[model samples]
Target: MQDTIRRNGSWLRAAGIVVAAVAVSAGTTLPAAADTDSWSYLTKMQAHEMWKIADGSGVTVAVIDSGVKDGSGWKIDSVLPGVSYIEPPFERPDYVYPPHDDFVGHGTTMTAAIVGDGSSGGPKGLAPGAKVLPIRTSVGTPMAFAVASEAAKGIRYAADNGAKIINLSLGWTPDWPMDKVKPAVEYAQSKGLLIFAAMGNEGEGKNWTNAIAGLPGVIGVGAVDPTGKAMPFSSHGPDTDLTSVGSKVEIRCAENKGWCTGNGGTSFATSLASASAALVWSAHPDWTANQVARVLIQTAGAPTDGSKRSDWVGYGVARPRKVLLDHEGDPGAPDVDPLAAPAAPKTPAPGTDPTAAAAAPRAEAADAESGLSWQWPALGAVAAVGLGLAATVIVKRRRS
Candidate 1:
């Protein structure tokens, strides 16, 4: 059920789970203009502002997706020598097998979205100082049995490695069971590595949740438009844990010589969430994954509808600024899992006032100047072309 289509000068994959090959414009002229107005500010995540507190130094985020290529204006020095789970007979002939060569371009884009260094007009990631561990897997054939097994292996690999956060911008169809990957997810959680997954993009019509997002250990993320509203295509229901800005963002693409604008889904939103965790972890290296996750949920802008939590936007849009800039939200206990089923009752850390943090005004939609804007060097005429493709791949194995 993952058909790819071109619309409004960009490609959109019908499913919201895996990374789809986004087609970009060929040899188009791009202005060197910096996106001073970060799309993250719409939800008050404030990447630029958060950087002032922490650039994710000494932190590594594992991107389990298509291979991450070098020279995409990303901080190549920060990209580690990562592992790949791809085997022979590639599903897509255009794809490069190595963990560093990304012909499919989805992994590269997701990597840049988290840690790109804004070189040569590339997208400046939320945590540019963080290292990205690329764990290559099948992109074109997401639903394949090999893909799930590889993803499970990739999670364990990331856990064994130095990755503090695992970004899963991929998932299978809602009805497809993730029995193959659950143990790996549990293993990652046991190792204190936080896992973030995209809550599929099939919207309400599908009305079903998919793994690894629906899995117990993973934090399921939904997509929100620039106006701080849940995207129509963003999958919803009980599985959603948090939300972030996911549409009309810039990205490095394989199909284009220059950066392309993505009509993002949960894929992009998951990256933002991972980057935010990187920032928090970088600043407080002593904090546990549980603490970081708790603060993020506590500081997040509550659902715009004034609800404690909503399926549409989860606990509301992620506003890391409240934690990084204002130092609000108690980190609570280090061992308590915030997202536990029948969620563990959390008491505020000693001398930390959770009520004061809750009293703060809810985050409102803001324009470019109002959000976290990246100050790139004076690159003349950096053009941001029309909205490029943002394809969402669905991972569903063929059932007899």
Candidate 2:
């Protein structure tokens, strides 16, 4: 049935869906303390930096996953009415039929990672002041053709509805191609939307090229551990644009179950990266998407390749504070893309094969200064303060 649905014209060209299915014989359990510890570190650093930038305050992030649970300790003051794209055979009339009803906690977890305020000692988000627009798709099911169609619809809806950042934590392997998904992504980008996506968690498996992550304009984020090392399970390659703390991040687990302890993957990492962009965007309202992106790439932590970049870490871990504090950084020419080097080739259009195009040889590994790395130290020290005193300490540190 799903294959038949994909045969449709125009829609058949969408990106492939790369879903990672971990064994779930055991029921989902609450995350352990170690997970909470990691989340505290990431969010605490975000707060201490005081990155209330112009990139994301008035911005709206459309979270496309399972539905979000409203009272999950996040400061989500407004949510545009959302719709459910999960094709239904089993129906519940009591449930408002569409938005904010999360049977599976994935979407809610992503939301908290982006805009949560740490009201109940849970994880604090990078962009606490931004708004969220929830769009529910699927949970525990394969990436059905109908679901992909619905996701495209959701992306279009988000763009039409005025969302500035679209965060997609979902992926599938046997799915649509770029031709189908490109229109939707282009539409959103045309509206000045910043699309952020997970690089997939199949690092332990084939570790195939992630679809959305590989898309030309989209920003792909990878996960890093508390110690600043890439997680063994984190997907790698030049496709990754930035890194964020993802290992052992804690979030609301399930109904009445309190918070879970093991929230690790590119799924959560992408959300944090989006929130980081939001903080910078919120602070600099005048900057365009390209300008904002350029700031991030330019100010990111040095890569492993020294002078150049590693295919695994790209420009390296994202550091929003570097952009926030650097009064002299150039946002770059408004028309140029930040990801592309001055001489990098333009992306090929639909029906044009990219592999056939001649490209520059990879540059020699460059040497970079290995001074005190900022992201890890900031995260480690903040987590040490514990969540109970996070707000007070964060405020005091920012002032000082």
Candidate 3:
């Protein structure tokens, strides 16, 4: 009896455990003004202070999504030669980029968030100086089976290339158990690539399950609002590494022209998290991925009572500004991986009960009363995974 939530004029079931399309709020806006409007998120995070120390100039982050579109203001050189896993045999097997017909604005929006350097009339990126490696999985549907293989190949490609960070805005389903993709995740980490992924946008909906939110070495990001509080819709209960501003974010759309304010989800949060990593890595070029991860966790803005972590907010909103400007981050040991899960890896057998899988009880409201009845839809995607994290977050998913 999963809770069903309706978003953007459609009913979505949580039983399926998928991160669906964007929930749009209708409003018209002029193109962003130089320092105000859609790009206000930068100001809220005090990004300028961090900018003085590190602008992500030397780092390259790989955006694994639908496709990345460039606006006129975007630097032609900053966007490296990327490859697409979608479309026909149009691109060479080794290197390619996205075609124009991106179904939704997801991938483009993410690119803007991570590294768009505002030009004549373009929006400024959080890591304007950092390069983005756009890897497209398909036109739409993050969960489709064909897209799954593409995403895995894309991860390996990103690592083998010069990608220092990889951002995965899409999620996978727990029912499908994305075991196929684990090897690729391991490969990227072995290459010292810092990976960040979205926690899914199902908190307010049916409160569905999430996959790999607690996967070892993968940083899982959640969302927060303007006041620096976790949104009620942000899925809680652990497996989240940190929080970032993700509500009503405005970005240049992938398929269309101009900015979109409707973008919201852990996907966007992951981009900001990815950008934060770029800023740090760019500043301290000699630091290892573990040092960056430890600093992010150590300097994260946590509870006033002084706990090291939070389930919903994770370590709290990423404070890269605090890390760089205030010198508050401890780089710690260079070799220690910060996101390691407590236990050894083990795959659950088929039909393993989800409740038993849910490790920690959610710190928020009690579980939804289970009387609601709704038919689960058949969306054959192995992509949408992670979240409803609980046990994975609280208990150690990696060995100590």
Candidate 4:
């Protein structure tokens, strides 16, 4: 049966599912550091200076996206065994769904932005001491319902495992109802997982609302440029809870095909937000999800217009430097959620003892920075999958 994804009540063009990578070669030349750049705002915030205090050690961020590429020079220190929900084309005998295999390259960029080691000339991650749990889902297809369901499964799986933070650098069109994945997000929060999601990239004129970012307790992140202005392309809505430098960012593509630059999107901003949380959570391993979120909100750059929060920049830009370097903000009560989402009763998973003790935070040393150079490629358009008939997806852009 053919799965069709519709947009604006009309069936859009569909394409054949791309083949999953059984094994990818790692011989492509990486981009040079001198030729590429990172988030200029992060540099101004002195993220490197803050790293001395905490580099996201003892934290695990679940990256639920198209897929993440695992290999040398990828800046990933450790990638845990992850799950995949991508259906094979025709159930071929040679089909193998590798969770870490990234064909779209979007997930790879998101991962590198969070924990990339900066060894292969790629951008240094904000949380270099953290581990990544890759949760691969269906993308590039037209079945929005299937895609959303897979993403929900990924969230639950990450929460049950050891993910302290979840990065959802993906979203659907404005009209796509988020009910399918909303419960899973709540379940993750109930389990003490902090989720950061993109607010979409429809810009000011066509600024569409993304409910995933607006979900209670989910940190909805938007994009801002160097001058503390919301990017014209950044989605704006009541759910917008935070902002990050989303313009002119650097990223590492799969297949060793060097680095790419001139990229901007809520997806990248979400990754940065996740990394910021990791840094705080690692420094204070015992803090509950709510406390960490409260601190992040309290320490974030406030709106330049003197407002507490806004539809465009949320609580201003995410600034971990204050929390790490200056020790600003209060973690607040551990039991209270900062985003104001009511806590759901925790339910034990099947076959698991409810009395089992929660696992202790992992203790890992931050990796040393490497001198290998890398570059960022121009953002390119790729196929995005989602559910419902009234939604449309913004093409992932590449600036070459």
Candidate 5:
């Protein structure tokens, strides 16, 4: 059950994220353009080196964002049939045209970061050989609750469809009812889906913990700039799990017309992290989700040891290169949750009702660029028979 998403193909969050849209009537890549020069983040992350051994061939990353359409030139494959949660009134007007005319090109961008082949003159993805399972969910502006519910459902759809790594460049405000997303998160984890989410670009704001990022099994990610320093906009809290290079990142729009430069946020970092996981998992097919997760963390470039973690960068930056190159790290237990202890499902807090909360902007954050953590919720009523989505991720996040 979801509301009709606005078909203008736009998700403009007041959280300060500039949703750059570049319309290309002919190309197949995606949305958005940048005013800055191009960046080569994958090279900086040393993805090419890892590709020598692992190209994430067997892994499938489920991108839960606007929608995905592999543009004309890029060599993207195995985008399994996807379903959209945006109801009719707001569905893309050109639905019959192609499957991935993503409104904001957000999902498409994330997908490319995970699996785009460089052949199309677009930016190359981290795990170019991995498959993508695109699941469309509403994101940005006026509808926090609806976005949460829709995203929850999308997560389940991805996991059920055989996605090994689930990437969510989306997140909810701190006070939004955790209940809305908790169940779906749990369900996905139970099925062995490794969840990756943006930590929200709210670190300089109230610096609160993101509801989805803070969940037990979810790997909350932060951003690092070209200099490999923490980005000021990335969300921060004890709950943050890891950091990745989110700044100066390049991603071609869905239509493959133009690209965004210097894009920085947990959203980009989340996809990279997910792509990195795909590399590790693909290289070690026998490893369980938990084992893959543990190896990634173990090989992460941490400045400190396990006893202390940075408040801003969490377990330090994601360096799948270290894991891939060394080929040695204790995966620990095959059936264990690495992020947090198990907890019972939480009910909505009294006086903190999801609807009553003001669309009053709460330190909103989405993409990099000085975004806040949460936009105030828009008032609208929508529903679905069962949010198999929300329950799916919460199951994974809460798994012990």
Candidate 6:
């Protein structure tokens, strides 16, 4: 879910060198700013402004990534013991693992970004009070190739463990077909899980895979800079459902030893977006996943025209604040599947290889036609005018 972004024109050139230098000097020790209380602090005030009306206090989000170190005190105490898809020993039957044993701080950092308390001057998560369920799979792994199986396994495990919202920040080049994991994803959705996945960070590298986001029942997230511009490195396309503050969005880094800092990419954006859903769900626990998703898409801050949806920005930037605060927002149908593809075969028959069959060129084409689309009505004239009035008030307040 994580990737670095260029500062801008000239900063883009120096970005690679800067990351390399930082990686070398920092070694496995994340940069000093990576500490929760040090550099990337998202103030309580800011959090309130961003998501106070929709604080995700009671919602539970399952983080499927590298393992999270609960010992860091960053996670809420109510977190259930997580399950792992990695091999035995590494995949403990019980939840707790070795203390402070985050092989890569990526998981922990992401956890903080989604639900950190901001107690340590760390970046405050959009849903600061939400509980987290950490499922370790790819953290500390060698590369994408080494962990595809484990990643899929973790997703299944998380679904089986009563997670209502699942957040995945990892990706693979040759994506593991959804057919291979559709059953697990369907199981999770049946149990009312809202899955949020990164759209990938390889927009510049043509081979990037948008599998998780492309699949039905998943919210594909792209990245945007602080100024609300789409990042060049952030993946884009019709597959993307929403965008978020990705670049310069401060967060705890995987490098620093139990510290927090700033990083960028659709990965962090995905976490933030997931946390937003958690908050909305927490506020309205009775609403189904589809309803929650409908609110998000319907209230998303973007233009209404389908063609206007930039491959870079998707439907528009995600605005959890708008969804949470708007009184007239619709949550959509409770029983409907937001990602269901009408034409695709429900499941592979007895002995067939779902992946091999689904991966064939023709199958890919068929799936594309059956992919998910947004059917929510446009923000009506009244809602648009109301939002404009609110924005004006906000701007005036800021000016004062």
lDDT at residue 179 of model 4 (Cα atoms): 68
Over 1-400, each residue of candidate 4 has an lDDT whose tens digit, in order, gives 2221223112112321121121122123324454444545457768888888898889999999767777623444567778888765453534556887765556777778888776655566778788889998765434434567788899999999999999987766544455668789889989999988787665433455466765667788777765566765566656677887776666543333456554447777788889999998988999999888888888878776576676677777787878888899898789876767432333556776422212211111111011101111112112442111124322211111
Could you tell me the C-alpha RMSD of candidate 6 in Å? Answer: 14.9
Write the residue-wise lDDT of candidate 1 on 1-400 in tens digits: 0112122112213211112212211123223354444444423455667787899998999998767778877765889989878774333434335788653456777788788887766667888899999998765332233566788899999999999999987756323345657788889989999999887655634333445665665678877777777766566655677787776666543342456555446777888889888988998999999889889888776765566676677777676777788898889888877776364344556886433422323332222111200100000001101111122322222101
C-alpha root-mean-square deviation, candidate 2: 12.5
lDDT of model 6, residue 385:
5
Candidate 2 residues lying further than 4 Å off, grouped into runs, are 1-36, 43-46, 51-55, 76-78, 90-96, 142-145, 177-179, 254-256, 342-400
Q: How many clashing pairs in candidate 5? A: 46
Instruction: Please give the lDDT score at residue 151 for candidate 3.
Output: 77
Candidate 6 structure quality by residue, lDDT tens digits, 86-160: 443233434333323344455666677777765554445667778778776634433323345655676677777
Error at 11, model 2, angstroms? 26
Each model's lDDT comes to 0.64, 0.57, 0.62, 0.64, 0.60, 0.54
The window of 10 residues in a row where model 2 has the poorest summed lDDT is: 391-400
Off by over 4 Å in 6: 1-46, 49-53, 71-78, 88-100, 143-146, 175-179, 258-260, 303-308, 338-400
All candidates in order of lDDT, best leading: 4, 1, 3, 5, 2, 6
Candidate topping lDDT = 4
Runs off by more than 4 Å, candidate 1 = 1-44, 90-96, 141-145, 174-177, 254-257, 341-400
For all predictions, the C-alpha RMSD in Å is 11.3, 12.5, 9.3, 13.3, 8.7, 14.9
- TM-scores, all candidates, are 0.75, 0.73, 0.75, 0.76, 0.74, 0.69
lDDT score, candidate 2, position 220:
74
Worst 10 residues of 3 by lDDT: 367-376
Candidate 2, residues 1-400, lDDT tens digits: the string is: 3433343221212111111112132234344443345455554355655653333578788987767877776755745567677664333323332678664456777787777776664566677778889988753233333445666778888899878789877654443334545678778888888888776554534454356666666777766665556654455555677766665666544331345656346777778778877877788777888787777766766555474444445566677766675553578787666665532433546776433312312221112111001111111112110001011110100000
Please report, as a residue range, the 10-residue window in candidate 4 with the lowest summed lDDT.
Answer: 364-373
Q: Which pairs of residues collide in model 1?
A: 11-389, 16-201, 18-393, 30-383, 31-381, 31-382, 31-383, 32-381, 32-382, 33-382
lDDT of 5: 0.60
Model 2 error, position 184 (Å): 0.4
Candidate 6 accuracy as lDDT: 0.54
Per-residue lDDT tens digits for candidate 5, residues 290-362, read 8888877766665343433454666666777777786667888899866655535546557663332222222
